[model samples]
Target: SQKTNIKALLASDAIGSTVTVRGWVRTKRESKNVAFIALNDGSTIHNLQVVADTAKFDENTLRNVTTGACICAVGLLVESAGSGQRVEIQAESIEIYGVSDPEKYPLQPKEHSLEFLREIAHLRPRTNTFGAILRIRHALAYAIHKYFNDNGFYYLHSPIITGADAEGAGEMFRVTTLDAKNPPLDETGSVDFKQDFFGRKTNLTVSGQLQGELGAMALSKVYTFGPTFRAENSNTARHLAEFWMIEPEVAFNDLDDNMELAEDFLKYLINYALTHCADDLAFLDARFRKEEDKKKKEERAELGLLDRLNFVVANPFERLTYTEAVEILIKSKPAQKKQFQYEVNWGTDLQSEHERYLVEKHFKKPVILTNYPTHIKAFYMKQNEDGKTVRAMDVLFPGIGEIIGGSQREENYEKLMARVKEVGIHEEEIWWYLETRKYGTAPHAGFGLGFERLVLFVTGMGNIRDVIPFPRTPQNADF
Candidate 1:
């Protein structure tokens, strides 16, 4: 019995040959004499059409092959008599492996809203939208590893549980074995972390950049692909309590080199998706256009999914200093009309609105904003000659504001220590990190890319939770 998946059978030249296929039923329509079943195996977004004669199977067997039911169909592949699909399976024999009751099945033939799908996360993958997103997600991740490996970068696995808060934001999920109701208390009447499993305090790592930098220092170039956690209680569409991050660190690379690396890496990922996931991308492109059609005329986007991806890949990203961006935003009509929620200033951090304006409105392309004010940036960033600014860069895309944030690291021991002390970050916590600067520290740079954000951007999904399989938001942790 030569069994074949729907995807392979659809693509094969053996159209006149018989093959056995297994998949879940997406929809089934019955005529007086024949039944047409749409079957999806999760190998592709498009379903394989199966035509079964009522005379070939018992009535009870025909009744069991409903939506969401599992079945094995032995059929001959032939050119489709239908309009939409290229091929269809003419079933000679059929077996119902599992029957799905039509009344209890959550998924139906009708298109369900994304909001409704989120409630049934377990079964959402059976839908076309999520299946396409997941396929693209896998392709993108594979492309990332291939690009890094081909570029002489080593894959570095960083610790998920780290003692040091890399971002210094103090927003971390504590990984503790201590009792929640009544933990060990010190003389200060506080819950003592010293008595915990790891001896001292520990929490989930917010970013692997610090550990990635350490690997780069020894191995020249390294990249980390791992899950990261944050305890931030924000319930926005973009914020996630736990998420995966891609961080690449390179030694002997300055801010300019860092920008080039990030740009090339992102382009590779986009191009890879286009080449490998053509069918899925096409499906998503059509889906995006339909979504756009529903929007008000003025609210719709300028470019569709494919055009946007091609535009980003073909064009060079606009480069400008953060100071220049702030200056331009300050002089823009939004600021003049008092339309901005957050006021634009020289030293203040740029909000999502300001970044979007610079990217989507002003630049009309991907823009790299460099040399940010030191006070607003991380402590490890190299201090610029201006004393007030640091060598930092943020890659802002058209719809997704800041996709990447990176900087040339400070190799100077004293300067790094001073910045650490200035920021009130305890030096003892990062003593090993300081030692790298003291001994044979070269000018290094790295950046962190939120994987979910990238997935959201590529899949044209509105919410970050939709791209990730099982989202961990502030209040919701359901699988």
Candidate 2:
């Protein structure tokens, strides 16, 4: 008996061998002759089937084990008799490690709604989808560190409680101690933030790019991979109130350099995910995808398990300037008159829908959309020579829009301040930021990649909430 991955056991080499494994019973079926229990131990996405005869194992013991009960078993591994599965365990010994109370247990082997699953967040990890997601998340995280470390980039930890809102989207989750009903006020009658939790108007960081830029200035290359909070109330599948972002900032880099770095970085991530999270990827491919998608995946698997990601990582992303992108849109979909919904004349922020159309339809590959209007982009984006567009780029991929948004920072102190003023952002609170531009801020560039969004693209999960372990939404914190 040896410890082995369930997927490896089923698909690879463990036939006609005895193995001892511990796992939670997903569900069990009992009969007079034998009983079948589908088990998963977090080793892989696929469950290890355990078939035991009623004569050898106590019927009462098997009957008492609930859907989510933890169990340890020693058994002979044998090939499946029918077309059900590849491998199963023939039990020689059975031990009920922890019995689950049936009435209180949330998982019941039924297809539960995602909302329902969110409510049982504590136990949802036991399911196949979540199990695969966590594994992929772990592998991707490891790959990120490996990618940065191998490339001579310093790994910098940005503070969670920060004085800056980097996105400037005004989505900062506030951190305060003043009572909402009756709070202490300053002489000016404003709520006194001095007595707050951080002793100032502190908030959870919306993005780590700004602090990461500091490290980039010093170290030349640095990345901050950590949790970022957004107080945005959007409840779409793509948006999350709390999630992780990997912000890699580079010094003396322009928008082109930034796009190249982003492309390489994304490919590096996809490659790492493919090699390391094979089991998880396989699990997700089989279980979560729709019937047609699963069949498509099966056919794709015949080509390769990582074919889609391989195409992305190996292929050169098609580059399109914002103007070219707009032209392409105009020529391609002139019939749709709702371009009015975009609400911008020639230069403006490209909405998510526009980004999707460009990547999913026109490019049919990852697209690096660059040279956006300076008015819509962040203030830090380096002003292009045209005196209008900024050297900014948003990497959009098929099925996912704006996977990474970045730009070459505005190095000139005066112009930086002017843009800051133009944005109506309070310059007083962010003096340290201006100082960077003043004293030795080497033309820096960086991008913010939503880690969950990348997971969605890589795993083909379609929803950001499904990839994160515990999705925190405005009205949801069920478990």
Candidate 3:
């Protein structure tokens, strides 16, 4: 058993106290008779330094113990009066437990590209940046659960496979047990597999919103947090083939109520990440600490500095309606003319460029755009009194556009059925959803939040692939 708590001991007045610690060596420095090595046990980002006599231990062992080798050391906790850090452990005896092969290991002390890191997904967690990202990921997940639980929302598990395409966009990745090489054929040239999966064809679910709505009809309020797949062919920073989605549906609620819920929920998550994951956040902040380091030195010399971490943690997101946002974009026509891929039309679905401009330049903060054209949106959206637009909204952040997409659902069966059919999907597939309105439908609303996009926004991470553990993209499943 190790004799001391590395965290407490390093943080205490107990300098030069006997202790023992086991961790993988990050790096080592050696001189004629003395040596210093940094050790990390995944306890925190800061490494504990162990000082030892190079002449005392086995010479061959010391030389062979390259980077990434696991070792145990009996040492003394001493104040690091020399420099670098507060305090570290001074060693008397060293023991090697595991040997990491030098030639085969991919990661070294130097920087590695994101593309290369994806190739070594399993080993990437050992890096400080990924470790911090994952820790924040856990904190964010817990915050989601905590916020919903405290607010009287039931956590509901929805199915992974469904017969209906809920989003009305056929981006589902099909699932089948039938042979791809030799599929059952009808007299027609096309393959007819009605005899698959007990009868009708099914595919991986694109969203749990429909099933979640069922739970809301029965229980008044429900939220589903699980994996959703998309077969989108575009190789962009914003799209992922398979990622997690958070859907919260409510009964007796309108679009206004839904918008309020989304804003509050997002604020709660950002607050949680900043509060609960301090060490992780610090580690993340440290990666961008060059400016901070320069500022600290300049402080004594009498100068001003920009506190980036403070700004991120305390910043309040701005909000705007869809029509208002469009007006702002139209005014910022210069930025749009050169940058946007598509023209910024008034009633058309807001392109990613328009969304980014509203949040990143015009508002200078996150903006929630509400009330989009019904024809440009999904069939389930509630129609506005204007006779053209729907009660749809998207939450756009500074760096990422449309992190969340949600709205008020059509509670009236007649209107909903009409829209569903007009959109050209088989109404029989969502017969149960339509029947919810028939039984005793009340006003209901909800939203779908992309989990990876949120992570990217919070971390200032440039790529969606960096936010997820093992990204599943088109023709590239490296893991």
lDDT of 1 by residue, 4-105 (tens): 888887788787888899999999999999999999999998899999999988889889999999999998888998999888889988999999999999
Best by lDDT: 1
TM-score for every candidate vs. truth?
0.98, 0.90, 0.90
Give candidate 1 regions above 4 Å deviation.
334-337
lDDT winner between 1 and 3, please give it.
1
lDDT of 2 by residue, 1-479 (tens): 68766766777666778888788999888777988988888878778888888898776688766799998888999888846688889998889999998888888788787767877788889988788888898888899899889998998999999988887889988887789899889999998888787778988999888788878878999999999999999988888988999998988887778888898889989988888887778766655445335565423222232566778888899998998988877666565436436743477577787887777656767899889888888777888889899988888976668888888888899888888888988887688878888778688888989999999888877678788888888898655
lDDT of each: 0.91, 0.82, 0.80
lDDT of 1 at 368: 96
Best by TM-score: 1
Worst 10 residues of 3 by lDDT: 298-307
Q: Which stretches of candidate 2 lie over 4 Å from their true place?
A: 1-18, 77-87, 101-105, 286-307, 336-344
TM-score, candidate 2, is 0.90
Q: Name the weakest run of 10 consecutive residues (lDDT summed) in model 1.
A: 333-342
Stronger candidate by lDDT (2 vs 3): 2
